[model samples]
Target: MSVIAVLALDGVPGPQLSAPGLAFATAARHHHPVAYEVRICAGPGFRSTGGPAPFGIDTPWGLEGLDDADTVLLPGHEGFRAVPPPGVVDALRGVVERGGRVGAVGTGTFTLAATGLLDGRRAATSRRHTRELARSYPRIDVDPEGSAVADGPFHSAAGVLGGVDLCLHLITQDHGEVVAIETERQLFLHLHAEAEDTGGTTSGAGPTSGAGREAAHSALADADREAAHGALAEAAYNAVTPPGSSLEPVTRWMEANLHRPLTLDDIAGRAGLGVRSLTRRFRAETGLTPLQYLLRTRLQSAQRLLERTDDPVERIAARTGLGTPANLRHHFQRSTGTSPTTYRTAFRAVVSGMTWPERPDGRP
Candidate 1:
């Protein structure tokens, strides 16, 4: 069996630590025993700090626990007030050197990046830390807009809850697209299973939903968190298309032609429906008109490109069908409350480092 080790820091989030084991464990049971063997390596002790629960527990193994694992995960934790302990950094470095997969959830990416493992690699963390990341780690390409990032053997996720999305993506990469989809369908049980499957959540602080999650996150409120993140994953999955609807064909066409300038008439013709009928059905099923949905998806793609690539805003505007850079910037600022350049500079994770100009407001 391939071993999967979860490395938990002293103040790691509880849900973040549990997420990998739950997802992978469930997957292994439906598949095979040889599929995975998961273990929690508490560095030196099993402890909860800055998590849902508070208490330190003991572990059977220390950093050596990761020595031969197939995958090593670092769940999200509070950022360091000082340099990482020597043992933690050494253990993480060893895992990568031995060809084991390495992953971090949320601010845990800081630990991995600090180890210099992510130097010049594409990585991601929660959006709140985006600018701090760019200013702190200059060489690493931190993808603020991405939910998950796989650079070589290092797999990094946005935040605590993003652990689930990252794990699902990892399964797809390790197994196949079919298995990944099945796992996603199962993971949706927490929210609205059997509603629709959009796919996964984007990168940021753990999702903003659920009483337990909010209470656990002293930084955010419970009601606000649940409402914000409650629909996101479902939206991602259901955004695929409603079953038994003629709109599926049109949806696929739109996704395929995101770079093309599309009009409602063009979409209606492709779906073999009139403009009025298409609009009505699209709204009834997807809760979005074809144009509205198209704009949102295009914006998402544009955001990703801005963070992960060196391509200019003008070029990204053309690819995402947003037309001119000026128009793209206007919409981007309106939607995300930040400029494209600022967004790109903050969330991109780097090991080598880059220079970030000080904001007039003095943010990263």
Candidate 2:
């Protein structure tokens, strides 16, 4: 099992501190074999801001607990601008030096940035603090628009629920997409039900149930059994024949023919269905119309080309069937918030240790 140490400091926000533990616990409740061992660790005098009401928390582990952790996480806190206590920075640096991953959520990125581990790396923090973070840490690349960003082994997330996103991403990296999706479904359902019961909105708030608190343990053993049984039954059915929507083959064809100037009628004919039937089923299965999927695929192809090759904008637009450089620029910027040239320049700078050049057209 992977050991995750959540470093709780004085004035740490309650939601951010507990979100990772809840997420990992939810995953353990669904997986057959438990995957994570999560611990809340802190040094002396550790307390939580408790939102508007201040409170104190006692943990079983201290800074020593982080020594053997596979991952160390720092959650947002009130003292984000204040330097960490003596030895805290050293402990964080030690984790990275020993090949362990480090992550932060919201203002916690400020703490991580203060350690200098994120210098020269892209990081995401709460948008509200973006300007202050950038001003404070001139070397760290702060991306205000990013909800979550992973640069090498260092990860950062924005907002309160951003911790859940970060945890889900980590779970996906450790397990597979299937496990991550299942875990997310179970957790979201639990949170949603809790919200409805309390007459609260089902926003990306942290979990608030006893089950949620004990998620990393055996609290949901029965639910895990039922989920496992259901999965086994599904797998048995899948063994007899492949499972998925009829649109699967059509979607695959679309991926293969992204460079072609395809239309809805062509897709419908290829799927052997009338346009209306094709549209309904495609939306049901893929959550997108055929044309939307096509556009998204082309944009993804264009992004890959920009990242991997030095292809000019017009050539890439032609190759991806985007038609013209201006069209590609409009759509690409709408989708990614950066032009092709700027995106390519930033990506190359990161991957190849190249410096970003000044372009007369104001591209990065």
Candidate 3:
């Protein structure tokens, strides 16, 4: 198993402290996923100051814990606006020199920057801090739009919640999209599971009707839930919304019915518009014509299936409406520069890694 050492400084945000471990632990629960040992390594004065009632955190390890870590994560501290201690900076640089990776959350990027390792690398922090980070380290490219930014051995997140995004990205880099998406699926499942345990509340809506279902969908959307939420989420969403719901968006209908032989007229009819009007509206919103959007949706669905299943190419063809194996291969090759089989083979376990586990086939 790989060790993930979180170097917690004083006043580290509560969410940032826990999110990376939650993501890594969930990833370990999924099929053939990487096993990780997450350790909280803090200094003598370390404590939580980001919440209303601050509390001291006791851990078994210290900065020395970072020495054997596969990845060292730095969560933002109250004093991040100033320089980090020389010991901390030297320990971080040593990790990189030894070929391990380091990531920072929110203002914690400033702490990582102090080591001078991110001097010319692209990094991300919250939008409010982008200007400051750019001015402080002019050679670093500060991107505010990405959920997370990775440059060589360094990684950074935009906000507290973005620690989850950064950990997911690092998981993808160390493992593959297969494990990353599965990790996301587990996280979202946990949210819904919490909701269900609390009596299936739909925020005052009655437990039974179109109004209730609509509220549920809205909640999912608020959670940033997408098809990436995996099969359980898709099934639950479909159970509520279904096809032909008066309030259902046309694009959503397209997503649910990717297995169908849909056409321009089919899509336009869902939106109660003519094909021409549908084309214009879709182009304006998604930068793709209705048919073009459908095509992209089909290919996206195919990609997900390719990543998540053992179903053969012929069945994948029918499922994505690509029609036949040859047609699917042609489009897959055109879009991805590879065949579906080859794509799956490569995506399944890229291992492709900082002291990660050996391949399933037991290669070094």
Q: What is the C-alpha RMSD of each candidate to the true structure, in Å?
A: 16.7, 17.7, 18.6
Error of 3 at 49 (Å): 3.6
Supply the TM-score for candidate 2.
Answer: 0.54
Best-first order by TM-score: 3, 2, 1
List where candidate 1 sits over 4 angstroms from the true fold. 32-34, 44-46, 160-162, 190-364
lDDT digits (tens) for residues 1-364 of candidate 3 = 9999998888887787789888888776542325799999984367665666777777889999999899999888888888786589889999999999999888889999988999989998877889998999898999967457888999988764538878888888877664575466446535431211111111222122475445433432322222233323222211111123342488767777766666566778889998787766654444445555555456656766666567777777767766556656655554445566766665544312212343442211
Error of 1 at 352 (Å): 36
Tens-place lDDT per residue, model 1, 1-364, is 7788888777877777778877777565433211677788876434576755566756686688888888888876664434665588888778878788888887878888888889999998888886777788999999977578898999887754548777877776776543454344334433331222122222223222365333323321222233244334223322334345667677767766766656666778898888788878866666555665566556656755655567777677767766556556655654455566665654444201211232342112
**Candidate 2 local lDDT, 133-196, one digit each (tens):** 9999999989987466889889887854638877877877776554564455445435532211
Worst 10 residues of 1 by lDDT: 350-359
| Candidate no. 1 TM-score | 0.51
Q: Candidate 3, which ten residues in sequence have the lowest lDDT sum? A: 193-202
TM-score against native, each model: 0.51, 0.54, 0.55
